[model samples]
Target: MAVEVGTTEPTEDVIDVKEVTRAERLRSMVARHRAKARKAAEQQRVNVARRVNEWFTSTDVTDAELAAEIERKRRREQHQGERELRDRVRMLREQLRAADENTAPALSAQLTAAQAQLQIRQDEDADRMKVSGRDLVRARWMKRATRIGAVGAGSLAYVNGVAAEPLLALLSLGAAPVAWLYLGREFATDEAPVVPAAVGPDGTPIANAAVPGTPFVPDTLAAMGRVSVVKPESGRVQGEKDLVTALIKAGIITAAQRDETHLAGVIRPSGPGWTATVDLPRGVKSSAAVSRVEDLASALRIKKSRIEISADTTDDGHEGRFVLWVANEDNPYGSEKHPSRLIDADRWDFWQQGIPLGGDARSTRHEMHLLWSSLLIGGLMGYGKSYMARLVAAAAALDPTVRIIVITGKTGPDWAPLRHIAHQWIAGATPDIIRRVLGVMEQTIGEMQDRGTELDRLYEEDPESVPEGKITPELAAKGMGPVLLVVDELQELLDGAALVQVAIEDEPEGGGRAKARSGRDLMVEGFARYVRVTRFVGGMGVFITQRPDADSVPTKLREVCAKRASYRVKGDRSAKMVLGDDAVANGAAPHLLGEASKGVVVLDQGDEQGHVTLKADVIDLPQFREICLRGRQLRIDAGTLTGDALEYGKEDAAAAAAALLLTDCLAGLNAAGIDRARTERLMELLAFHHPGRYGEMTRAQLQAQLRDAGAGTTKKIGAVDGMANANGYTREQIAAAVKTGK
Candidate 1:
């Protein structure tokens, strides 16, 4: 029996040892291969994810959408990985069950490894609870409670043993409940500090921070005071190079583009943020750049509302520049403080009694002198042209000595603020209304001519009394006051409206439309002809029109007017039409102005530089009405609220009509140094008005009448061929006699 057992043991031991060695070697090889395969598969999946993520650089999709897509892809990969792990584990278990007892150990080892891998996979999928801020807080509180309770209990035991005081023991025992409280692991929940959501310029919240690997999360989220945001460092403007890189990354500019497209000028601090003057690319116009200002601002990571992109173009339209005004805070214009009141006597004196239109972009007051300067204001619709006209009228109204005549052809509520103070407020563009306006214009011209003669007589009488060869503050104070002739929507009148309608009796025998003439002709010949010169005679005209065409706002009138302010217009053509020929060339690109730049205008007030940017005051309807009320009250108190159409007595009307006739007809006819008797052509001109009095009277009768009224004079005045001695009425002589009431 011993010999047999020895022989069997030797054979079995040899086979078992060989089998163990072979199986162990196979298992080790399989383990290495499995590790290598898993690593290679993971590397392949990482490569695919990397390739997919690279699409974000060129994709136009938002970051949030891209993150969602990446998350979906990762979820898909996770599910596939779990399925593969399950298949591997099932195959390993089957192989272990089919193996014989000797090789079973190797297969079992493989199965165990597979099972462990599956368990790790399942554990990951189980959504294990991570230690949150609340847990950490509770743990800290528990530790502190334990320490305090231990101290309390020790103190209680010591007090009871040393002092043997019953009261202290009872208090300590009751407080020793701290030990029981500390033994409890749970703690009441408290509000935890959390990262705040970031917001965009439009107040859109950016959910850019959550758990790591979550969708819509940033690579690095930072807390900036109360604003928790992604890439907070990128919000600050570093330099031009950084801006250029951002632009390129934002697809606003290509790297191949030249420096002009990338902003050639240096950026400097202007108010809140830096301002840079960038020359647009050769092919790109400034208007194009202005259009994309929002995109540019977004690329720079700035608030879109805090950016100002003003553009200037050359005459040839080949070159242009963009003035980029970027501010850290919103509302750059709000930073400037402007006076609310329109009338400041001190500022008025500094402006030589000019009107304060508004403040410029630099917050400096834009005081325009309408005394000896006509104004041509033109702009697009809704660009504050009518509002500007109201401002002028309001300014005139504040001065008791100034008269306001407003021609509001718009027929809208835009001029409601000026109704209280307007002297001759014409509100329609009908034929009869325009004809009446023409009559008003004719009457104003006649009055201006009369004032000119009056001024000349005053100067001749006393040069010191008439400081300049025009109406002074003293003259205006003395009641020979100023008149603001505001014509808004002048295009309506110039669009072939009626001028002066003649009656059938007054019409000539030619039988044409004799009485009805075009208003444009009468305006060009009569009104605009003398409008500029009348400023010196206390009558200033403001021609405001949305259409700045040759017919609407004639070039002749534009040439006469020394000051022009234009708002956003159609293009450079319209800007030039309103401002001047060199407006666009000199950086007055009204075309680049937009509704976003409301109240911004390009003013050319006879400055050597073409035009300047004037950010007009924000005159709301309520404020305007208040200003009008104040002005009206002022005029009423001063007793100088006389208007062109105010009710007057018969004597006053006759005197005013006689003065108009003397200057408009007599003086104008005698301007060529021609001598004529007062009873000849002068009486004839007067007889047309007072036909019943002097139509058939003799020259002797007219001379007697004038001498009785203290107006005629004997003078040697004639042309070279027709020199004669006669009784002629000089303007100064008539003015003096009329003033002295001789």
Candidate 2:
């Protein structure tokens, strides 16, 4: 009844109770609003996340660039690098095609490059990132398969679109600056500048954020490219073996060169950026033949000098280092060379095809006389002038008829290596000492002249068919050993006018009055005489300096020099001075050194033409890692060399003291089953390092000689004398005879 009547329609007895309480209604309203607010907040957050993601991924629009271009100006360089890589690949293929040419042995240089490329591709495929695109147009396609697989097909379709379909893929490449600003993982503002490393105005670092007073970057360990995946390819390399092969082939090289060439390591980009590394030899001395050393170095930003080279030598031993600078540049960047360097490496006396000595009109004729011509070689401070010079002395020492004498003012780095070869030296800029030494050399020359005159008188007294035709080098070469003089850092000593004048005057003086004084003076004089007329005397003179100019070497000395070479010369004037007419100087060549910048020069030894524009040779501290490691153990001072190895004309040196110290050469030879002990004893006697003296004995007497070189007393010497007497060695018979009765 109550339900039927609208006015009395209260279901539960129509109690007059308010169903909504103000507080409860407010709470309910608040709850509903809170639910809506939560959804709105979640949506807001989702939108924010989406926006952040979008910020990372750019749309396919030409103007959607956001990141700052760090090295926007270097775009040209980037393109050049890519182009060079491509061209290199092409050239290597050509080399492989002509692998059988030349007599050096049939080696397909391209095969090695191709194999290396394939190997790198395999590595990239396994570890490289996967980016979505219809086709990764700029990205290199590295795969082991000739036919695209499911993964590759999907990737290609996503990036480049269907190969058969007419679709254009708009690539979103971030500017270099933007890449660093956003994509680069390095968060700290501490980053190296785009400029090179050098002392700033306040002597602070301008680029690198490296900590002070440390050799390497703090808290940083360079990643190494290890465990590469090598893909097997067919007879021809047209696919995956492209990039690496291109790297090897980019230089003007031959298939035979590659065949004989060894791969120390293949460098490749790594990590979240363009990181790369090189795997080196076990000893780091294992050498590799490269096309353009500068290009390789520049591309890798690695040191080009200090590249310890080793090649197959004769059993007796053969070694040599020559500067072939026909294609060198003075201002490399100004030239047409791509990448401006070799393989990201620093210039450290890295050899290359240099600039043409007489511009484009250059002759390939080389007329250098190994026995008679004085050669001039130079480079900047960081270049490899000193190292290369040392190598030259080493080469000279290999000849039995050559005697090396060294004089230097380079604070020991240069002189120490040649301790065995150098008869005289000063490691620092000591003009007075150097002058006195030169005086003694002049006196020695005078004495040699006197001896020659006396011999002529004797010959006249007893007529002979051979009349002395100037008693020239040709004659000397037939009888006597040639002399070699190496001066390291002549610039430091010949820095001032007074020093130069004094040095010039000192050449005429005999040694000082006293024994040590005379000895020092004589040694110095001997060194100078070697430089003055060594070539004419069937000898050689090697002059090394960071600064080579008219000032460092006076005209009196330069007149005879027929060869000019350098790793890199900083100044155009210096380049001209060292290279002579080859490049052109202010006096002889005005516009030849037109740009007048780093790594530019011309080389002329009379008509022989050579030129090179390049940065100084930088010791490849990476490949020379072993040498650097040995630097820890290098002794600042070194004494005279003594031993069987000290024989005439041997110029090679074992520079790393650590390696020498680590192993006993004698013991090693013994282990290799060589009879070094007997030879060592003989060495002691011949070098005068042992106690007993063989001053009067001749070479013929050595057959029967029994003098104990290690004997420290007269009694012991006498005992040895008795033994020698029994063996038919007589002091009177041998000592009284001059020239061993020859």
What local distance difference test score does each model get?
0.60, 0.37
Steric clashes per prediction: 0, 87
Report how far residue 390 has shifted in candidate 1, in Å: 2.3
**Residue 122 CA error for candidate 2 (Å)?**
31
Q: Measured by TM-score, how close is model 1 to the native structure?
A: 0.46
The runs of at least 3 residues in candidate 2 whose Cα sits more than 4 Å from the true structure, single-residue gaps closed, are 1-368, 447-479, 496-534, 548-550, 566-572, 580-601, 608-742
Query: How do the predictions measure up, each by TM-score?
Result: 0.46, 0.33
The C-alpha RMSD of each candidate to the native structure, in angstroms, is: 32.1, 23.3
Question: Candidate 2, residues 446-536: lDDT per residue as tens digits?
Answer: 6446545654664678545235423333333343445556666666655521343332233335665322233333333454455554343
Q: How does candidate 1 score on lDDT?
A: 0.60
Superposed Cα RMSD, model 2:
23.3
lDDT string for model 1 (529-592, tens) is: 6676687777678889888777777887888888888888877688888988755554555666
